[model samples]
Target chain A: MDIPRHWRLRKQRYGLVGEVCESCNAKVFPPRDICPECGKEAKTLYTFSGHGEVYSYTTVFDAPAGFDETAPYTVAMIKLDEGPLVTAQLTDLENRKVEIGMPVEMVTRKLRNATDERGLLVYGYKFRPVMN
Target chain B: MTEKIELLKPQRPVGIVGYGAYVPRYRLPAKEISRIWTEGQGGLPVTEKSVPGPDEDVATMSIEAARNALKRAGIHAHQLRAVWVGSESHPYAVKPTSTIVAEAIGAVPNTQAADWEFACKAGTEAMVAAMGMVGSKMADYTLAIGMDTAQGRPGDPLEYTAAAGGAAFIIGPAENSVAEIEASYSFVTDTPDFFRRAYQKYPEHGHRFTGEPAYFKHITAAGETMLKATGTTPEDYAYAVFHQPNAKFPQNVASALGFTREQIKTGLLVPMIGNTYSGAAIIGLTAILDVAKPGDKILMVSYGSGAGSDAMVLKVTELIDERRDKAITTIAYVERRTEIDYAEYVRMRGKLTMK
Candidate 1:
């Protein structure tokens, strides 16, 4: 079975972050290779807090070619506390229960572990709902 | 000895003279893909394929197409006076990709060559530009090529079809051409069916919105415009080549447009080759050129997600028949596929690792 290429990290910091450019308040995540706003293109370590409101999402009935085992997984775009919305999988919930604007928290866990093209183990984080 | 003082621009009928295709030797087996995505034991009905190699890029693909076009046009690249390449995913964001292609293909120095990017329709648009230029007698011959390396987000449903490929055509005087451009029609609207933000890594789709509004609407509009302009029905042409976003969308759109399923099968390469982005319908155009008999009128319609469409009518000439007998055709190219398993697909597609 296929897994993410970066699924080897032993420590899982389950959350999402984007850059709120100090040069120009633009919230970005996964870290921008360059800044579209303010031309800051500067790589500032802008830390983003999760606990986002779901904007939209899908039950993902058709998981990608390699994500069969993780079938019926829910992927969504959640507007974060930092202003930018991101797409991530919702966990600890059923497909029917996933609703728009549903408050959720970011949690990092083993999405999938597998050998990469270069043949190395990889790991990454996904998201889930947090009940207040 | 000075050239004659030509007050009015001469009109030269430039059209496609030769065509060729190159499908990668590697294929990713659908069962293997299903093994990872489905039950891990061949759970799907279809297998996706990909070209496995690093050096292969939009530039390389264009070269292959140009080489074939030159061979079919029966002229060395040096004999060509103009060249144009249309692609959205050029190797460099700033560099003119046409230079690399022109150099590799030996287009003569001081030739008019550049790239075009109007979403997926850039390739055909290049054809339009070349035809206008050559038709006005600005140049004697020109080569137009369409190529792409489609990108999709990791784990996105689109990953199933973002494959890379290319196609090329040489346009010269119609009397010496392999296909005559019978008619051309286009449609554009302020619609956003699909879009990818810069540095966002993958495209953002509007889901069902893409089906009715941007994709199907524009294709139908353009195809109808061409049919009406040319005064013909679906039964007039032997085949129809469409810009294929998926295997299913083509069928749905064709049924609605009055073209039968048999007519639509000529250029539906998305299911097997994935979405070649700009190369989709144009490659289908080349595939048709490979199989079409002389005098076959193939109706071509291209759709780009940002709500634009171009419909063109091409009548195959005997020149392509001779080339078809000696060179590659769509069927032979389709047969040379080697299937890749789903795990490997993830790696090749950048969705998974080999770790």
Candidate 2:
């Protein structure tokens, strides 16, 4: 990923910052300016609690370009406590079986080593099983 | 007339307003490392070491710890005046990890940020500076973090103990502090105990030279100086924590300084989590603070390989009990472990070269 693109998404990537629709009281992730729920302007910034559960998940054996090193990792659709589903890679599995409703929490992590070894280290949020 | 060098104290009292520790959930057992290299020949330095994930680095881990510290501090990120990260394993050579940390924690635009290095004591070095910033009223609060995703040569003895994890501390006025910093002393000298050059992938050490003349000398000097300057004896402290390169170093140093096994056991986490380099001493201090009570006096000493030591005395305040449970405890991170074999460890650590 390029520097400007990464820089623009930092707030969303780092702290799960998204938009909340005032008209409909809906939380919008990936921060679209227009709210899908109410078709209104949703510009207020809201930081997610980062607490969620695995709504669904899958194991990827065949990796994508930048994520080859961490192939065979788990990716999940997380249902945030405040009502938004976001896709993320699950980490620190510690060999525990990921269930449909297993609780997880957000953590900052290197999303990938971008461009090349010397280029940029793109960091963002990744989720892990909540420590009990 | 004789000149006197006094220990560092903030002009006004400053204390740890909030603190947090982060240990990556992956574990690489010593025996697994031994199986590949030593064939189980020598005694393992530690039971296992914490390993960062393929996606984790110093910046990521520091942000996690700093968030936890912010959670416990009950303070807004914008209120912070500085964020200083101390580590040897910052991912980027030219870029500053402190900025990334500060931005992630939402302390940017108004905060003074930088990175500090003094080998393993890098974290404590930041802590000392934070005390100065807050104590001198230059800043109302400053965040100092000591953390590392330390690497070791594939088969070197350092491999068994050089590990991942760290802790973060927020220094603020005594009124909001959980533990008040009474005084701090630093002892430093020119010594070549360990080095990893500008482009070196792995660090080189002077073998046994790292022990007596480097680690012991500086730690003892700093420890004794702090003790004498405070007019307190070892018995005065409820607990003592020293820089743990491995389990033995802190134990041996604690014994030599007249602190008993019981006094240092709570903070001796290296036996399980390995040495977190810059995070070593401060992480141990976090564990001590986890269970420390009101009015409990604690002694902490951190040693770096350059070499030098920073010794500090802290008195736990009544607010400790109310604040400690606000975030995840150090023991919880230690216990939340996933054991991985050598092949997995190699893959995660990127030890194997690939085209």
Candidate 1 wrong stretches, greater than 4 Å = A1-132, B1-11, B29-46, B349-355
Docking class of 2: medium
The per-residue C-alpha lDDT of model 1 at residue A26 equals: 79
Candidate 2 second chain TM: 0.99
Every candidate's lDDT:
0.67, 0.91
lDDT of 1 by residue, B18-81 (tens): 6656555456654454444555542232347455332245765676567657666777676677
How close to the true structure is residue B24 of candidate 2, measured as C-alpha lDDT? 91
For candidate 2, write residues B1-355 as lDDT tens digits: 9657699988899999999999998899999999999888889889999998888889999998999898888999998999999999988888899999998888888999999999999999999999999988999999999999997999999999989999999999989999999999999999999999998889999999999999999999999889988999999999999999988888999989999999999999998999999999999999999999999999999999989999999999998998999999999999978889999988788877775
**Which 10 consecutive positions of candidate 2 chain B have the poorest summed lDDT?**
B346-355
Q: Candidate 2 residues A1-132, lDDT tens each?
A: 478999999989988989999999999998999998989999998889999999999998998888877778899999999899999999878568999999999988887743257777888878888877
Distance (Å) between predicted and true CA of B323, model 2? 0.7
